[model samples]
Target: MVSCVALLGGSYDPVHAGHVALAALFADLLQPDQLRIVPAGDPWQKAPLQADAADRVAMLALAFEAARLPIVIDRQEIERHGPSYTIDTLKNVRATLGPGASLVFLMGADQLMQLDSWRDWHALFDYAHLGVAARPGYSLAAASLPPAVAAEITVRQGSLEQLRTTPSGRIYLAETLAVDISATQIRAALRDDDQASLAACSLIPPVVLDYIQQHHLYKN
Candidate 1:
């Protein structure tokens, strides 16, 4: 069987249950040899992160502690100095994995729609297969994407079998259970001392929530 590595990159400012659930879902669907959760060091496209990198990493470790599969906390992007571009990260991972190992780059349906705007987005397929997770009410069909992305989708889309066997140049859409949770809302709840909101959402892991309270994070 071909060795496979799945990459799921995000800020993970304070890794929540939703993130954990998504990782677990992908692990079951892809069955990669390793699933790496990469935290962004400096995400150029988004606002500045609220928590420090070390704190985020620590929370991620705790959040994924009970995961069914062994999930790795890849700190390469967090340790790097400049902006964290997906293409650069993918290239580095590809080089480390060599040519034979299959690489899967995981993303949400929202990211898929905005993929054309990413830096060197077209070349991403060269290094890893795109595994887009379906989000609630978001369409993964090619017709719904931008012209360039639709064209690529039409040509590079592949089945689960091809994704499992081939090393690269395939786009696979995996259906996942809808977990309507966001780090933004979690942070806001922390800031506002809204236990009701947090409990209602039920997205933050207990350990992670304890860490956040211990560190007094996201109280801005």
Candidate 2:
């Protein structure tokens, strides 16, 4: 059987339950040999991150402590200079894993909607297969996606087994994921007058909440 590695990359500003759920859901379905959590160092398209690299990485560790699969915290993007791009990350990962390993890059449907804006977006499939999870408001319907992204995914859609077995160039969509929390909302809540409101929301893990509080993070 081909070895499969699932990569979940994000800023992980505070590492919330939604992020953990996405990884857990895919881990159960793909049963990949390894799962890597990649925290972005400098996301080119987004505003500055509220939490620094170390804090974000630390939060990710705390959030994913209960994960069943072996988890790796990849800091290549953090160590790399300049803006972080998914294509560059995938190229480096592919080089490390060689040609036969199945590399699945996971993301939400919202990201898929803006897929065309990513640097070298079309070439991403050359290095890894995409495993996209559908969020609450985002639609996976052909009419809901950009023409290019919709056309590309239309032909590459495959089963969970195919995602686990294929080396690259396939798309697997998981439509049952109901997670809808956003890091922006979590950060805003952390900065609010009532910090307890964030805890009540249950958007982030308890351990992560502890870390944020202890670190005095996200205070403006």
- lDDT of predicted model 1: 0.84
Poorly placed runs, candidate 2 (over 4 Å): 199-201
- Give per-candidate clash totals: 0, 0
lDDT of 2: 0.90
lDDT for each residue of candidate 1 in 1-220, tens digit (9 for 90 to 100): 3388888899887787767777777788878888888999999888899999889999988888876766788889988889999999999888888988888888888789899999999999999999888778778887887889889888998987788788899998777557667788888888775568657335788888889889989889
Q: Cα lDDT for residue 137, model 2?
A: 94
The Cα error of candidate 1 at residue 179, in Å, is: 1.8
Which clashing pairs does model 2 show?
none
TM-score of each: 0.94, 0.96
Alpha carbon lDDT at 116, candidate 2: 98
Worst 10 residues of 2 by lDDT: 193-202
